[model samples]
Target: MQTFTSYDGTTIAYRVWEAPADAPTVVLHHGFASSATGNWVVTGVVDALTAAGRRVVAIDARGHGDSQKHHDPAYYGEDAMARDLVGLFDLLGLDRVDLVGYSMGGVVALVTAAAGRRVRRLVVGGIGASAAEQGGVDRNSLVGAALIEALLTDDPSSISDERALGFRMFAEATGADRKSLAAQARASRHTPIGLARIKVPALVLAGVDDWLATRPHVLSSALPDGRCKVLAGDHLTVVRNPEFAAAIVAFLAD
Candidate 1:
């Protein structure tokens, strides 16, 4: 529940779980419509990382979670989101750190990491480059909008239960704004040029059942220095899976 000011003077929110002083710091960026607490803390991912002696910094991206919400769709671009990360690091006085991003956050990490040398190691889960290549028009475009509309019904309880508790949590945390959420999705839908510029060690993880980031299409050619891991489950379930977390830890440790 800490806050920092971005370059644009937007008050960004982040939660830090400190481990041993010597442990490597890892930053977690949640997907669209997800907050640090809902996506990582509530799911026990932040706790797991801290218990394993890693300092975890999880952020609530602009227009989502507890961060400042600019209704302007223009502020949701990948470079803009990436600048937020850079602003966070600058605000915290961090030189370099490992980064783990899911969904839209993954695209931000990719663009950020590609643009500079600040990331030590990177793990991208539940998304791929195609979503970026497609200019952010993934299945979520249809599904997310539908889900948002469902939330505005007389009783959102039915819609909340459809994707298990995770979707419900996401819907509640985002305030169920379809236009702003979709704008964020659209903002993340394009890949930045120059993949070969990114020289950092990277791991790209995609869920086998994730329709948004299909295996053969997105993972294969995403990063110039990227390694791929295909796990079992859909996008939501994959982030919390113990095996998936372990893989991320192992990659960062290497």
Candidate 2:
């Protein structure tokens, strides 16, 4: 568990699995409320990337995993997350990398790519362009609030929404810091952005049934060099799919 200090003095944690020195390195960003281990390592993403002869650098976003956790909403934003990645790259001396991000991490990747970071290839999953355009309370804010309420009150009965309740339960089950996650949710909002600045080849992938990331083709079309692909299962299950790993390996290899 390697650690680096972000520009804002936030401690960030990351793990590097080395491959051949000449092989292209891939940096992975996990979804909302998930750690690098939960989203990438445990899901076999690290193994697949390593097996394909690629070096892997997996990050635990602020307020998730072993990284520094903050309950202040000021600590999180799409730009903040992007800055964290940039700091990680600078700390590790990574000149360029293939960036793979899922869900909330996908938004961070887009922000980073748009900011002219050294991303050679971008693979975004469980998100769409509409997400990049929309501005409002995110889908997870309610869940975060519910989790916060439950955590503060120590009573699950306070949450009314079933989806929010489930999220709270999952967070509790996973031993997550509910306050920090809730703060993250409150701070994160998808603001409209132009994708024309991103010149790298990108692969937009998601589950066919993922309503949260509707119309991935729209996102792909926005990119100068982008394409979309759908796999079986919903957003949650698709991460466990072997095809997901295979597609990424093939795309990067190409």
Candidate 3:
């Protein structure tokens, strides 16, 4: 329940779990419409990393989770969100850190890592570089946004039962308004910039059945030193798969 002030004076909240002072630090960014706890902590990802002797820093991005939310849609841009991470590192006195970002958080990680050498290593799952190169608004993002709007309006019948349930789970975890979340998703979405600048080791992972980020798009040649791996399930389930965690642990350890 620790809080740090972003550059714009917005209070950002993060939970820190550690094994020792010298343990490698891994900062996790949850997906769009999800909080740090719901997306990772409750999923046992943070616990796994901690048990493996890695320090974990999980943050609730602005307008998501326990952090302060702004009504301005412009504030949700990826560059601004990436800047918030840089501010968090400065506030905590961390020189550099490894990053694990899922879904929308993956976009922020790509932006942050591309900005400079702040990241030691990066693992991006449940997302791809298509949005980063294709101006962010893809068919999937548009569909995802429309579904969120329907849920926010309490029109559950507008979406499939399973899809509605998924949105409900995310809503409960992040406390983000459906319309606002969708607007943010549309606004913050963009292609990854400064890709040629990233020199750190990177692992780009996607679920075999993930509708949001498909296989060929994620495995494209744009990413510098980027490597891709496919997991066994869809978005949410793949994040918790044993093989997924093993891949991350092995990459970070290397």
Candidate 4:
């Protein structure tokens, strides 16, 4: 695992799967409560990118994966995470990269691209129009509160919301730090992320059955150059789709 110090002195962890030197690098950001391995590597994203002759850099966001974890709510948020991503790019001397981010990472990607950073192309997965219209990641507000409660609660049965409960179960099943994730949940921001500021070609990819990504085109239409495509499954199963990587590879390659 390679490491870089973020702007706030946070230790961010990333892994590089090298391809030919002339190959373009693709940076990947995983979903919330998920690490690079869980979101990209295990799901065959890294392998697909590398096999396609592209150098892949998969980063574990703060409070997730092998990155530094903290329980303070102030330390966690998509804005902060986006800063870390930009910092990594600057630190690594990456002039430009094709970025692919899923779920929470998609929010971070939107924030980064909206800031007019050095992204050549962008692929936002598992996110929809409502998220693009409103503040950063819409953990759904009330749904978000339920998630926080589910993460910190001692009894799983107490979480009545099926989605939030499932999230809690996924976190536990993955052996993630519940406290850090809770802090992340607590820090969910509603600030508007200016997607219109991004001027790069982007692909809005998601599953037809995914609730979080209900109307993919709403997000696509929001961007200057963007389009939407949906696969067969829901949130969890979407990444497993071969077309997921195929679509991303094709989009970034173009």
Segments of candidate 3 deviating more than 4 angstroms: 21-23, 135-141, 144-148, 159-169, 172-175, 216-220
Q: What is the lDDT of candidate 3?
A: 0.75
- Residues 1-254 of candidate 1 have per-residue lDDT tens digits of 99988888878899888777574589999886777876687767777777778988998888878888776668787678789999988888788889988877877787778788889888877666564465342554345555444534555655543542354456665575545565665455454445667778888888888765665235536566778888887877777777777887788877
Estimated TM-score per prediction?
Answer: 0.83, 0.92, 0.88, 0.97
Clashes of 1: 3
- When 2 and 3 are scored with TM-score, the better candidate is 2
lDDT of 1: 0.72
Candidate 2: deviation at residue 224, Å?
1.5
Number of the top TM-score candidate: 4
lDDT of 2 at 173: 67
How accurate locally, in lDDT, is each candidate? 0.72, 0.82, 0.75, 0.87
lDDT of 4 by residue, 121-237 (tens): 999998897667766565563377788888999999888989888889899988899999999988866788887898999999989999888788999999999989989889899
Where does candidate 1 clash, by residue pair? Answer: 132-191, 135-189, 136-189
Number of the top candidate by lDDT?
A: 4
Candidate 3 on 67-160: residue-level lDDT in tens? Answer: 8877667767767778889988887777889999887788788888888677999888887656456634244543655555654666555565
